[model samples]
Each structure stands twice: as C-alpha cells, then as structure tokens.
Target: MTDFESTDRPYAAFPVRIGLQVQPQHAQYADIRRTVAAAEEIGVDVAFNWDHFYPLSGEPEGLHFECWTMLAAWAEATERIEFGALVTCNSYRNPDLLADMARTVDHISDGRLIFGIGSGWFEKDYDEYGYEFGTAGGRLDALGEALPRIERRWARLNPRPTRDIPVLIGGGGEKKTLKLVAQHANIWHGFGDAETIAHKHAVLDEHCRTIGRDPGEIERSAGVGNKSPEDIGKSMLDVGTRLFTVSSSGPDYDLGLLRDWVAWRDEVNGE
Candidate 1:
C-alpha cells in the first residue's frame, strides 16, 4: 500500500489532545517549571520532557536536567496536565524500579500520568554515562524484555498505580517498534510529514492486525515542531491522528507555538 492509502478506519474515539514537550535543556528549573505551568494554563493536554543527560541540540554542554525527577516535579506542579517523558529510554533504568517510580509519580499527579518510553538511542547518552553502546537491534531487544517486567512490577507494587498508566511509545521503526506498539503502547508517537506518518500508521495497523488487536485502540501522536500547527494538524487529523505534540526548548521555554496548536485542538474538538 502507498503512503497516502486510506485504511478506511474510524477516527480515534478520543478528542484531539495537544501535547507540549519542553526540552529540559539550556534553562533553569524555575524556567522549565514556569513553561509547564504556562502550557497547562493555555490548555495543553500533556506536558513532556525527554530523558537525557546532555543537550540534544544547540550547545552540547548546555544546562540540562534529569528526566524522571523533573517529571515528578511536573506531577506536583501541574494539576490538570498529564505529564511524562516524551520517550523515556528503557535502557537507562531497571524496569522494575521504573515501574515503582511511575507509580509514585501517578500518586503525585493524582493519576495524571502517561508513561512514554522507547528503546534507547543516542550513543552519547550511553557512552558518557558508561552504558554499553550496543547496536540498535540489541537495544530494542532489551526494551522488548523490559516492558513486561515494568508491567509486572506495577501489578505488584504496594498502593498500586492510581490508574492504568497509559504507555506512549515513540518511534517509527516498522518491524520492532511498531510491533511493540501493538503489543504494549496505549499511544504511539511518530515524527514526520503527513505522508510518512500515514505510511507508519499503515504499518502499525498491519502489526495490530497480526496481533489480533484493533488499530483504533492505540492512539496516534505526531510531533509538530515549530511547524504551522493548524495546517499540519488538519492533515494529521485526516489520517486518524488525535494527539499533536509541539516541542519547545529552554533558556526560555516559549509556548507561543504551542498556544497556536492548543487553539487548533480546541477548534478540532469543539472545546
């Protein structure tokens, strides 16, 4: 099937959700905190920070903060916005420990948590942190193994998660990534233009069909980085995408772009 081929599938049952990933780099904690607070005030549904030790762009050694800790802070700070890492690196922490942390954060947020995770990438994060920089396939294999452990730990935790913490898995690797999405993810995040997203959507659908899971059960999320939110969001919506994420970085975690996207989402959902 071509990229543009429609699956004749129904739109996702949920209303459109707008997410803002405020990169925890080149900024102070207070600044990041303000950004998230502003985002929630402006009607952003989800607030995200990526898991990494160093900056991913701009100055490499620029100021940066840790992921889960910041997520915990975000949990305490925001009352309405659901929060998590855009995609937590599965290789960074032991799976069981991660589950417990997630549970704690769930309580902190009073049940507003989305446990977004993915196979580890970024050799720099691995090498500098003394983690083995293995091949991509190896990392994915490790992730596949860890996901089950995380779930099992969640089940066994004392005062279990306040809710079934939604897992949002990122990436568009057709074979392994999409397979894991079908098996595990409640929300699947992919980055690309409309055509690329449509193609991956088709691949994800196939994976779901193979696993006897309905594709509509997993929400599709797209990253709209500094793009025309209205134009691109409309395209994404046409192809069954309901979550649109816009990422802004620190020093000054501006939400002007995000505000536009939030407005677009309100229009789409008639909120």
Candidate 2:
C-alpha cells in the first residue's frame, strides 16, 4: 500500500463550510435571483451558479442566464454568502480576461468571490458557442497552460482582488487534474462516494508531496446528492473533507437538502 493508506496524515482541522449551487437553468432570472437571496438568509456559506450557455436539464431551450453576468448581479444582490460559478469553463474566456472579471466581482462582493474553474467539457456548449470542442486531454492541457496565466493576470490587475480569492479547481482526473489541484488549487471540488473520495484524497496527497506543498493547504470539497447526506457526509468528513455543497437546479431551486446539510455542518463543527 502507498503512504495514503497510512494513518499518519490526520484529518485536517477546519470549520465545515456548506455551499449551495443554484443551477442557472429552466427558470426566470427573477427566480434565480430570489433563490440566491434565500440561500444567504438561510445561512449557507457560499452560493454558486454553473457556467453554461444553455440549460443542462429539462427543456433544451429554456429560460437561462449567462454565468459571469449573473455572478455580477449576485455580488450586488446578496450580502453574506460568497458566490461564483461552481466551475467556470476555462476554454470559454481568455485566462487573463477571466482573472480580471473575477477581480471585478471580488470587489463588488466586498471580497466574497471564490474563483471556481475547470477544464471545459460538454461538447454541446462548445459546438453551440463555436468553440473548438477538442478531446478531453486537449482541454486539460489547455487548462494546465491557462492557470499560470490567470494567476499572472491577477497579479497585474489595477485593484488587486480584495483577498487572495480562493481558487477552487473542480474535476477528478487522477493524473493531470489532481496534479494541477496540488500545484494551484486553494480548494478542490471533487465527486464520487466515500471510497472514491478517499482514493482521490490519497492521490491528491501524493501529488502534494511531489510538489512540496502541504495537502492540508487545499481544502477538500464534494457534491452532495439526496441519497443520504448525513451518512455520506460523515464518512467523507472522516476522510478530511470539509466543504460540502448541495446543488439544485431551477425553476424551483429547492434548498431543503442544502439547509439540512448546513445544519449537519454546524453539528459537526461543534457549534
């Protein structure tokens, strides 16, 4: 067995944070806006919108809004919850330009922006928007190239980001993706079951060691489905995962599950 199998790396001690991703599809912008406000009032730590041109579910041509613009609106609309795209597609915008947009939103939200980004998938999004739509490997390669440029651009922005602006990289590719998570990500948004997450954490640990960075420096995040939030969340938390996000799509954007998770978070955080 590898070092990941060893029990030496204790669970990273940190306050649990719960986030809600209000999917920006099949709903009027008014509904989406209202949902965000409610999520903040309910005491979620973060609010997120996915970056996509069209709806990912329900009617193909449904009421949908652009990602960054809605985020700008969210920055002004809500007070407490930090917000951003769950995972903005790097291929959609130039890296430097994306960094600038993030900085602008950061200031607007009074430093309440989390820069969550990932390599673009969803061929439909690429085809409809006239992008290249290359292989997954190609997209990952492009993302690897873009991250540094994005950071460089952040360094040069006139009004620097209100804070370092946590970089959340989403994806579970073990080889390249996990390596990038080790090198750059402040938070790593992941997927899969407790076993899957444990394995990913182990792989991430190996990469972190290779890069001479502490694995604890990058917070572990995962998406929570409706299956059994309490059971699954506890198992994940045992493995050092701290930030749990429950994603719901519109037209309703029901956050009942998210609220439960938030309560669960408080219980675990010892509040």
| Ten-residue stretch with the least lDDT total in model 2 | 1-10
lDDT of 2 at 127: 94
Q: State each model's CA lDDT, in order.
A: 0.88, 0.87
Model 1 C-alpha lDDT per residue in residues 1-271, reported as the tens digit of each score: 2232235754456578899999999999999999988898898999999999999999999999999999988888999889899889998999999999999999999999999999978889998999997999999999999999999999999999999999999999998999999999999999988889889989999999998999888989988877976568667777878888988998977778888888877776666
TM-score of each: 0.96, 0.95
Poorest lDDT segment (10 consecutive residues) of candidate 1? 1-10
TM-score of 1: 0.96
lDDT of 2 by residue, 195-245 (tens): 899899999999999989988788888887774465687677767677888
Residue 173 displacement in candidate 2 (angstroms) = 0.4
Give the clashing residue pairs of candidate 1, or none. Answer: none
lDDT of 1 at 106: 97
